[model samples]
Target chain A: MLNRPATDTQVTHLQRLWLYVLCGLVIFFLIVPTLLVIPMSFSDSRYLDFPPESWSLRWYRAYFNSPEWLQATAVSFQVAFLTMLLATATGTLAAYGLHATRARSSRYMTVLLTLPMIIPVILLAVGIFLTFAPVGLNSTIGGLMLAHTILAIPLVMITVTAGMQNFDINQEMVARSMGASRPWAFLTVTLPQIRNSVMSGALLAFIISLDEVVIALLIAGGDKATLTRRMFLALRDEIDPTIAAISTLLIAFSVLMLTLSQILQSRK
Target chain B: MTAADHQPDAPMNERALDRQARAEQRNLMALSLPAFILVGSLVLLPMGWLFWMSIYGADGFTAENYTRLLHPSYKKTLITTFELAFLVTGLCILLGYPLAYLASQLKPRMASLVLLCVLFPFWTSLLVRTYAWLVLLQRRGLINNWLMEWGLIDTPLKLVHNFTGTTIGMVHIMLPFFVLPLYASMKTVDYDLMKAASNLGASPVRAFWQIYVPLTLSGLGAGVILVFVLSLGFYVTPALLGGGRVMMWAMQIERSMAVYADWGAASALGVVLLVMTLGILWAFARLTGAIGATEGK
Candidate 1:
């Protein structure tokens, strides 16, 4: 019923071509940088150069052998994992509570939750810097996770609440009446339905925590430096193909996670 | 008879049980307490600190910070930021709407694929994406290299480190943001209405302009506001692409705070940006409400 042509076939063809071109442009730009990084990573020269005369795994080996890169990446992963856990737990509970409430109150709470996303990270970093300095959170893992969690929580809340909106609350009630406790009902009846949303939210939270730099720079200082912070420092001091190698790895990791999420989303 | 029959003891027991249930509900709602505590401690508290810092001075509370930002150059920087945000938002809408429309017209599987493509770039690092743009748009980078090879020009074009390069990179980052929301809103539009309009002897364009555009305006507005606000706060893209050529307010704030260690001026700049964002958001909410009312009618 929906696919029937409502207009001239010629126009639709033109539209399709135009759409393809636009989408092609997007795809081209999206992948070009990533592809470019491949050649730069293999560059025979010491600097980041395109269309290298010779290709080798020098930079890749360099990255793998360097303890600094390895340690920074591990730190990034640890921070991201902890931030994801904190964000998911807080966000899922908050979303469920807010979603079950009346519309007006929920709307107000939603805006409040979005503040972390809407406010500038620099402003956030400065405030956290001041607040954490007094409490000795500066240059500590706890401080980094705390800052990252604040930003990540809103993302989880938004995604989970979106999933909850379309849910049948009566089913939850039915489960409750069947002698299932509230927590048990939620686990059996609600969690599975919104599992995809939760996973996506968690993925988003992890990515944000991993990619974040400004807060890490401000609070983590030098000791708790993240991979991004390390890269930022590298860029400040020099331009090298090692960054290209790291970028390639990051892109690959993101793609793998995204593919997994896609598989999960499709199951829904 | 009704008052007496409503037996005092029975009603009292019900009231006590009700109070207990209410207490349980309060506990359940307390699930939100952690979020509240976290946000208050990390977010709201920090913002309060920022506000205090903005007003504080070497001596005490003073107008010096705000007044310092009142300089002509600072004013220019603020205006440039607003202007850049406005332009990027506009460009995103212009380009994003058609793609969203076409995407909505696709089969579900294909639509999902298209959406994946849209989101793929978004998942990539912004730092890397900006750097990629630098390669493609650089003087002797890919674009100009190809152009020169094909005899389009003898000399390489000035592409990177300017307004043109900045716009290109900013728009690339922002397109998906605009597209996703617009696509979400467009999915909710009634295809039957458009078909009915066309079936009633209205041309496709006429029906689209008359009905489709109006219905989708809320989505467009939402997307525009999202992009604009995001662009205002953008740091990496402008920093990389502008290459010290274009100076926006965020860059100025960074310089003041990081380079000069001038917290007062930086905080003042931040407050101004915050207030402007809040004001625009208020306006957007009002517009959405107005549109909602019209839609209800």
Candidate 2:
């Protein structure tokens, strides 16, 4: 974007003022709705409002004290953690495999593995529900973990594959030639170089599982319901400001994970 | 170097080398096995069942499941879904293009701030954002209250639980999807061409329209296809905000399964949605590939 002569910088900036203002509104529209609930969550009243006249942690207390909310939160974290591990390991392997194999079949294999992401969740959820029912895994924690891992893998594959573009396979091959095992060469020579993307992909996998709703809505039930599923059910009943408190916490958590990923990505 | 490129030292060594190379290829391919097994069981196997259910009936294989889609109720929902998808995609284009254009033109640090703002809502829970809109656009919600307080209206407007609410929420959700891809493509474009045109006596507007805009069209097309496909299968925002007034395709699919408990109906609807989504993506890929081939020629 190197443009405009040094003498023309001020003129061009001034000329683009209207464009900036328009974009500013678009950015406001993008972010404000999500951020507004942070304050609304602390309201003394039960309903959501902007710039509360009086502030209290009534809703936060409601979220923390409720056993149901706590249980769902615990379930979400456990499932998400397991999903992150499952998805990252498998997806990273698949990405490396795709990069390693010069075979034409790898192209079709890539599409086959990533198909879950493109298909509608409702269909996947229903299919997963039926799939799990026969195995007696429906409504169980393992079922949720497996379903989410599939959804999360495509993202990991995508990010790790993008990261692999900057790397050379010959380095790993050279290490292998120098009396190192294949896994050893990859772990010692390749993984360190691509660790940033792997870490970012892991974080992404964690968040996708944590935030997924449709599958959880269909397949997760009983005491194992996810936080998102619970919040969704709660919202349908009413706009209890308790959910606003929970949303604020979730928004904060997403920000933290994204920041961590950014740090990992930006670091040398 | 590959084993194939190695010098033929001895016949026994050569056979061992070939075997080692084959083993290495197999081992590399083996790495993808876990993902294949996991996804295949849950996603692919279930999809096969969905196709079967769509055709299967109590008596035998039947076409009634798909034929049911011809009902006026289903037809209405199908029409509404396409309309909403188009409306949201158009709104995203109108809003996303300028923001991406501006972001591409800014300093690197400034551009990141703009991108972060775009990505914030995306990272947040889909349900939370839909809830935010549900609160803001509802009767006696903030927007309606503001308009009344400012004397712009005598009463709170019906801003939500309807088509308007769904559109606003969907657009908010889809905007980042449109902008990020557009911004990436725009960043790769050389703006020096536009400056050269300006120097060569073309008007700024003409240069932008003829040169710069054409360069960004591929990005625009990508954003358009992505938003449209996503919107077609969207369920969360519409369900949370539509108040049962709007019956989009995904909502219909959910209703068939959840309300009617009809696997055949749900599977049939899901099959159509999947086909449309995949069909559009396949067509777009070919269209872009064709354009690239012609340009290369």
Q: What is the TM-score of chain B alone in each candidate?
A: 0.94, 0.94
Q: How far is candidate 1 from the true structure (C-alpha RMSD, Å)?
A: 2.9
Clashing pairs in 1: none
TM-score of chain A of each: 0.90, 0.94
On residues A1-268, what C-alpha lDDT tens digit does candidate 2 reach at each position? 3234321112355566677789999999999877888888888976666778789999999999999999999999999999999999999999999889876778888999989888888888988998999899988889999999999999999999999999998998899789998889999999999999999999999999998988998889999999999988887777778898898899999899878877887773
Interface RMSD of each: 2.4, 2.0
TM-score of each: 0.92, 0.95
What's the C-alpha lDDT at position A2 in model 2?
A: 24
Candidate 1, superposed: residue stretches over 4 Å from native: A1-10, A46-51, A102-104, A236-238, B1-14
On residues B1-297, what C-alpha lDDT tens digit does candidate 1 reach at each position? 686877877978999998877766665566767877788898888787788888987898899889888799998888878888988888887778877887887889898888987888778877667766776787767788889989999999989788788888899899889999999999999878877887788877788899899889888988999999888877777877887787887788778877898888888888887787778888998988997898799
> What CA RMSD would candidate 2 show?
3.2
The TM-score obtained by model 2 is 0.95
Model 1's TM-score against the true structure = 0.92
Can you tell me the CAPRI class of model 1? acceptable
Please provide, for model 2 over B1-297, each residue's C-alpha lDDT reduced to its tens digit, 9 standing for 90 to 100.
777766565687989998987877777888999999999999888888989989988899999999889999998998999999999999999999999998997889998888888877777889889888887888978898889989999978888888999999999999999998999999998867877787788776688788888899899999999899989998888888888898889988888888899889999998899899999999999999999998899
**DockQ, structure candidate 2:** 0.61
